[model samples]
Target chain A: MWLYFLKRLGLAVAVVAIVIAALFAMIHAIPGDPARVALGPRASEELVAAFRERIGLDQPILVQMGNFYVSLLRGDLGRDAVSGEPVLRILLSQLPDTLYLVLGSILVAVVPGVFLGTLAARHRGSLIDRVTSVISVSVMSIPAFVIAIYLLLIFSIELQWFPAIGAGEGVLDRLHRLVLPSLALGLAWIGYVARILRASILEEMNEPHVRTARAFGLSENRIMYDYVLRIAILPTITVLGIGVGHMLSGAVFAEIVFARPGIGKLVFDAIISRNYPVVTGAVLLTTIFFVLVNLLADLVIAWLDPRVRHDLAG
Target chain B: MTRNTALSIRDLSISYDTPEGRLRAIREVSFDVARGGITGLVGESGCGKSTLMSAILGLLDGAAIVESGEIWLGETDLLTLSRGEMRRLLGDRIGAVFQDPMRSLNPVLTIGRQMTDIQFRHRLSRRTKRERAIEMLHKVRIPDPAARLDRYPHELSGGMRQRVAIAMALMAEPDLLVADEPTTALDATLEMRTIELLRELQQEIGCAIVFITHHLGVVSELCDDTVIMYAGEVVEAGPTRALFEAPRHPYTDLLFACDPARIRERSRHLPTIPGTVPGLIDVPPGCVFAERCPERFAPCGRLHPRPLRVRGSEAVRCHLHDPEVTS
Candidate 1:
């Protein structure tokens, strides 16, 4: 099992390396002058040229990539285009906010989503199942931005429940302001999770072990939780792992709509200003985070299901 | 001795609400299994044999509704107990071993955990439960119970898993054990070993066993009394020796004739029961086996025959077996 994980880790590292290279090349390939953008539109030609030389923009693309990789290995993510501050420092400061939002939304989505999904499966064709199905489908069908805008309008503009723009002062305050955006993101995910889990549970509930559990005189709750849910929810864990990256991407759009001072807004500003260093750092950090989350999920799945470990070992 | 009846059923009818409508699976099924005796419930597939077992165990699904019945296990009517009460009694006093041992045991749990869980449910101390689990495993004659306890269900072979399941069922020392086609999925040697294990366990535990199967050879070998069910009803029932020697019901006679051993002994072509068992949804009004019985008469198509006592020790549900009838 450890050997299999090591192999997977190797493959993941290769994939991430390829992704970083591609992202670096693509960002630089855009028809624009990074030095001109950095020095501002009003800067003299000499000033722009001097800025380009300082940043090694005149070097060959391969040489520049080599330099970037070397600096990346040394934990130096270059300088921000506008502030000339270390891009790594700025990213480290903003990392927590993105992590908080993504993790919170996932927690809010997974618990209730799985619970409702299991309930729907166990009482399939019942009124509760029908109602949950309709609600989840409706939530999923609507676009996230639309939900975010609607929530903003309701809570910020009309109800005066939360601030209209910017993350609030303290951690609790930031979380309070984040409630609408997280829900906006989580609403769509809850529907998807519930749908997947419902299908899985329905399939598992028909399995003979479930029948055996019932025959053993296990209560409905015990059988559902212990036998049915344990097996059925395995697929959901894998899906959740894959969905983490998507959720982070969604958080970008959500932050923009809510005007929260997080990584999403930082990325938007950097993209507009052509801050290549910040962009590269943000993308790399997100990729690494995703890979790490997936690795953790894999470990969790192995722990929950011994068969997976056996299969891996075999 | 009279008080030793472990399971007594009377006029039990079970039906399910399917898409087509209400379908009767078993009708007026009645039988009694005395304590410490193995009662073999024998029938072909779709003959309501399994339905009868599920009904008696109170394990029928949501769709099935018991129309009328009394499933008395000791002083308690199992049919009347609340789901909680039934659950408490089940696996403690009444154990069950299902067909397809691969599916019966929880794939995620170890054999030891499965056994100890039942013991735990009955509120046995953890240490005692653990010791009893190993003891039960030994009782099933599983080699190296201590080492095998840690192995998951998939690690063991099919026959070994079946033995583990049986051991788990007997962990609580239940008074009645239901073996539902316990050896059907096993090879011949494994099947014999499983039967031997069951008989030995029964001898040690002194438990009443309801062994449900289609194989008459198994019934002849292990059962003291046998009930031959046909199309949701008992067509013939009596002492195993008497019923096997002189099967009065034509369906029973045809079943015996169809056996390969019997056909070889008679040195004749195997007699096959013509036509399939009728669908439960539209069971015939008269005799369920009338369409398949070669000796069936016109009256067999119009009137359902009640089980009549024949020759003191046997009961045959046929017009021909009625003492008043001369035919």
Candidate 2:
């Protein structure tokens, strides 16, 4: 099992490597020179050239990437062009706010989502099932930003239940401030999770093993939770990895609407000011987060399902 | 009901609501599973063998409707019990080993966990349950039974998996053990071994078995009594040897003839019964087997023959054998 875990972790590290390369390539491939943008259009050619040489923009893209990799190994993500502050330092400070939002959203999405899915699956054709179905569809149809703005208008501005701007200080305050943003970001995936899980449970209900479980004279509740859900939840774990991506993108909308200080807001500001190092650092961190969570999800799946453990071990 | 009667199905008619209209899956079928006897329920595919098995277990599909029936386990009718009561009785009173061993046990669970989990009604301690699981596994002749408990279903070979499934089913030592073609998926040699294992286990446990299969060779050797079902009806049912020697119903006779083992001549093609099974959606207003029956005589196409007593403890459902029978 440990060997299998190491193999999966190795695969995840490789994926993160590819993602870093892609991120670097895409940013560099964009129109306009980074050197000119950093130095400003009014800077003389001599000064711009000197600046470019200083940042190693004068070298080939491969050399620049190689230099970046070496710097990454040294725990340096370079410095912000304007503020002259370390990019990794900036990201680390700003990351916790976003982590709170992401983790909280996942909690909001999964707990109720699984409960609703199990309920709907149990009462398959009932009024409650139909209601949840319609609601889930509507939630999926609406954009995360729109939901964020509406939540801001209702909860933050009108009701004054939560602070409308900036991530709050301390754990309790931060959690309180993040609740709305987390809900907005997580609402769409709740629908995805519930619908997929419900379908999965419904399908698993007919599997031969489930029938055998029933014939074992297990109570419906026991059979469902122990046998059926154990099988049904595998696919949902995979979707959760992809849902992290959705929430990351949705974080942009959520942080902006709620006016919270997070990696999303930090990246947005860095992008606007052309703070390339901070942007690269934040993107790299985000990619790592995505890869790490997926790897964790895979490990959890392996632990839950022995068949997968054998397949991976092989 | 006799105390020896482990399970008794009486005048059970089951139908399914299909797009093509109500498909009559089973029609007025009846049988008894005597305690300590292995009863073979053999029939073609879609001939209501599975339907009857499901009904006996009280785990019928949502689409199926029980038009009329009573599945009596001792004095209590299984059909009359509520879901909770049935749930309580299933693993304790009416244990089942399904057709496919590979699909019978929960794949994610260890063999021990699945075995012990079925003993919910016993209220035993955790260690006691685990001990019982290992003991049952030993009874099924699984090697190193204590070590096998930690392994999942996929870890075992097909034969071993079937043994695990059987061991799990009988963990509670249920009064009736339903083996639904338990050895069909095995090779001939493995099938024989499984049959032997089942017979020995049944003798030790003294539980009635409703073993469903199409393999006549296996049934003849394993079952104490045999039931031949055709088109959702019992065409012939009696002592295993008696039916094999002299089948009273024409359907049973034809079915016996189709057995490849009975082929005496050196022929290119193996024996196969001509004509397909009748569609259950629109059953003919006559005998269910009339269209394909070799003895399709006068009134055969228009009259549905009622089940009649024939030889000692044997019953037949065909117009040809009827001395005085009614629809």
Candidate 3:
């Protein structure tokens, strides 16, 4: 197990390295001069040239990439081109809010989603199943921004339940402000997670072990929760891990709608200002996080079923 | 004749509702197991043997409905028990071991965990449960039983797993143990070993066992009484030795004659009962075996044969066995 963990970690590092390299290449490939964008359209050509040199844009792409790589190894993500703030510092400041929103959204999605899915699965072919299936499917089919806007209009503008814009301060205030955005982001995912879980659980419910459990006189609750859920949750974990990547992207729409400060908003603003360092830094961080989550999911599944672990070993 | 009945099923008829029509899975099947006796229920696949087991266990499929029946476990009619009462009775008063040890146990749980969970409803202490689990494993002759506590079902070989299943079924020391073809998936040697183990355990535990199988050898070797089913009906039943000596029903007679072990010389082609077991929806109203019964007469197609006592403690569902001699 230790060897497997180490091997996975090593492979993750290699993947992240390639991702970072690709992000660098892709960002540079876009037709734009960061220095020129930072300088106004009315700025003089000489000032622009000096600005380019000051930011090391005058160097060759290969040299710049090597310097960037070295500095990244040293834990420096460079300065934002327009704002001149350290990209890493800006990201660090934004990281907590994003983490809170993402984690909260995940909680929002998984709890009720799993509950509804379980309910639907248990009462399969009944009215409850049909209703939940329709509701979840509808939620999934609609766009995230549309859901966010509706939430804003109903909760903020009409009901006066929450503030519509910006991430608020302090622990309690931050959570209070996150409610709308989390719901907006999570509602759609709830439907997806619920659907997958319902399918997985229904399949597991039919397994021969379930009959064995029943023959042992285990209650339906024990059978469903203790036995069936353990097997069914494997696929759900994989989906939820993949959901992390989706959450990050969805947070962009959520942040944009709420005008909140997080990685999503950070990336959005950086792109508008042509802040290459901040954009590249945020994307790479998200990618690394995504890879780690998927790895965690794999480990979890292997832990659940020894057969899978044996397969992995061989 | 005065032997105590452990589990007696009477007038049990089960049918499955489908889009096409209602299919009778088991048709007024009646049988009884003597206390501490192994009663063999044997038939070809799809002859309602499994359905009978499920009905006894109260684990029938969603589509199935018990049209009429009483499954008497001692004084209690099992079909009349509430769901909770039934749940309490299962694994406490009645335990089960199924075929295919590979699929019978929860793959994700350790053997110890699965056994402990079975004991949990009794509210035994964790330590006591663990000890009981190890003790049961030992009874099944699993070597290093204590160490095997942490192993998953798949980690054990097929024979070892089946033994574990048997051990689990015997763990609660129930009055009845329903084993549904428990050795069908095993090799011949392993099958015999398992049957021996089961017989020994039966002696030690003294639970009435409903041993379902298609193996006549198993019936002869392990069962005290044998019930032969053909197309969801009990065609013949008697003491194992008596029935084998002289089968009254033609199907039973044909089944015995077709036994490969009974063949003196190796033949290129083996004898088989011609025609298939009829589909549940297509079963003829008269004798279910009439289509394939070589001894069928004019009256065979027109009337369902009732049980007729052929001799002491032996009966056959055939017109030929009738005292009036309708055939």
Candidate 4:
């Protein structure tokens, strides 16, 4: 198991490196000069050239990429083009807001998804199962943006239950303002998690060990929650882990919709002005986060299923 | 229902409502398990041996309908009990071991945890439960029972898993143990050892066991009374030695004829009863084995024969044994 962890850690590093390279190439692929964009379009050629040399953009692309990699390793994410501040410091300020939003949304998705999915699977083929299935499918079918718009209309615009604008001040203020956005962001994924959980648990219910449990006189609740849930929840954890990237991306739109201060908003602002350093740092961090989430998922799966340890060893 | 019997099954009928038609899985089955003795229920595949066991356990599939039956354990009819009542009875008053040990255990849980979970309803202390678990594993002859407790099911071999299954079932010291082809998946040597272990456990625990299997040799070695089933009906039932010595039903005689151990000389090909057992959808009105019975006579095809008491405790369901209205 420790060996499996080491191998996965190495693989994650490789994935992050490849993603950083891709992000670098993709940023350059856009038909715009960051120095020109930072200066006005009407700026003189000499002025633009001096600006390029000042930012080290006058060097060859490979040399620029090597410089970016070395500086990234040294914890210097470079200065923002528009703001002229250290990108890492700016991201650090934005970090907690994004973490609160993303983590809140995931909690919203997982808790209800688990309960509804288990209920659906328990009363499978009954009215509850049919109703839950229909609800999950309908929710999943709708796009996240559409759901976000609808939630904004109902809770913020029509009902006036929450403020329709930017993230509010203190801890409680942020939590209160986050409610609608998180729900909007979370509903689709809640449906997905429920669907996966329902299928996984239904499969577990048919396993021969469940029959043995029944014969052993274990209560239905004990069988479902303790025995079946323990085995079935592994796949759900995998889905949640893989979902970290999706949740981060979803938070971009959510932040835009709610006008919140987070990394998503920072990335959105950076992309418009072609702030190369900020955009690169944001994408790089997202990739590293994604790779780390997937690695954690793999480790969790190995821990849950012992046969996986044997397979890894062999 | 019968007096002083550990399990008394009377006129039990079960059918599956499939899309094609209603398949009669078991029909008019009756039997009794005497206290502290093993009763072997022997038949070929699809002869409703498993269906009967499921009926006894009250664990039939969703599509199955128990048309009529009374499964009496002591004075209480098991069929009349509520689902909760039946659940309480299991692993306490009754225990069961299934055919495939490979799939019978929860692969994710350690053996010790599984055993503890099985006994959780009894409200025993954690320490006491662990002691009982180790003791039961020792009873099943598992080596290093204490260390083996912490291991998962996948870590154990098929035979070892089966021993753990037996130990788990017997933890509550049930009065009746239902073993449904428990040794079928085991190799020959393991099969012998498993049956021997069951016999020893039965003797020590003094529990009535309904041992279901296809191996006649096992029945001869372990059972005091034997019931031969055909197409879900008990065709012949009596003391094991008496039925083997003088089988009243022709199906019983044919079954004995196919027993390789009873043959004095080895043959190139083992004898088999010709023709497949009729499909459950269209079970014949007369004797179930009439089509396959070599000694089948007149009146064997048109009219159904009820079980007729022949001699001692022996009963046969055939026209030859029916003394009334002789043809």
Question: In terms of lDDT, which candidate is strongest?
Answer: 3
Docking class of 3: medium
Query: Which candidate, 1 or 2, would have the higher lDDT against the true structure?
Result: 2
- Candidates 1 and 2 compared by DockQ, better number: 2
Q: Per-residue lDDT for B73-107 in model 2, tens only? A: 98999999998899888888788898888887889
True contacts kept of 4: 0.66
Predicted complex 1: CAPRI docking category? medium
Identify the superior model by TM-score, candidate 1 or candidate 3: 3
| Model 2 Cα lDDT, one tens digit per residue, A36-102 | 8877889999988987776667888778788888899898999887777898889999888888889
lDDT comparing candidate 1 with the true structure? 0.84
TM-score of each: 0.92, 0.96, 0.96, 0.96
Model 3 lDDT, residue A147, Cα = 85
lDDT of 1 by residue, B222-326 (tens): 999999988888888888998888888888888898887666555556667779888888878888888877887768887888888887335688987765543
Off by over 4 Å in 3: A59-63, B1-3, B323-327
lDDT of 3 by residue, B97-131 (tens): 99889998999889999999998676779889999
Report each candidate's C-alpha RMSD, comma-separated, in the order given.
2.8, 2.0, 1.9, 2.0
What ranges in model 2 sit over 4 Å off?
A: A1-10, A29-47, B324-327
* CA lDDT, every model vs. true structure: 0.84, 0.87, 0.89, 0.88
Could you tell me how far off, in angstroms, the CA of residue A2 lies in candidate 4 after the best superposition? 1.0
Q: What DockQ does candidate 1 score?
A: 0.56
- Candidate 4 lDDT, A105-159, residue by residue in tens: 8888899899889989988899999998888888888988898888889988999
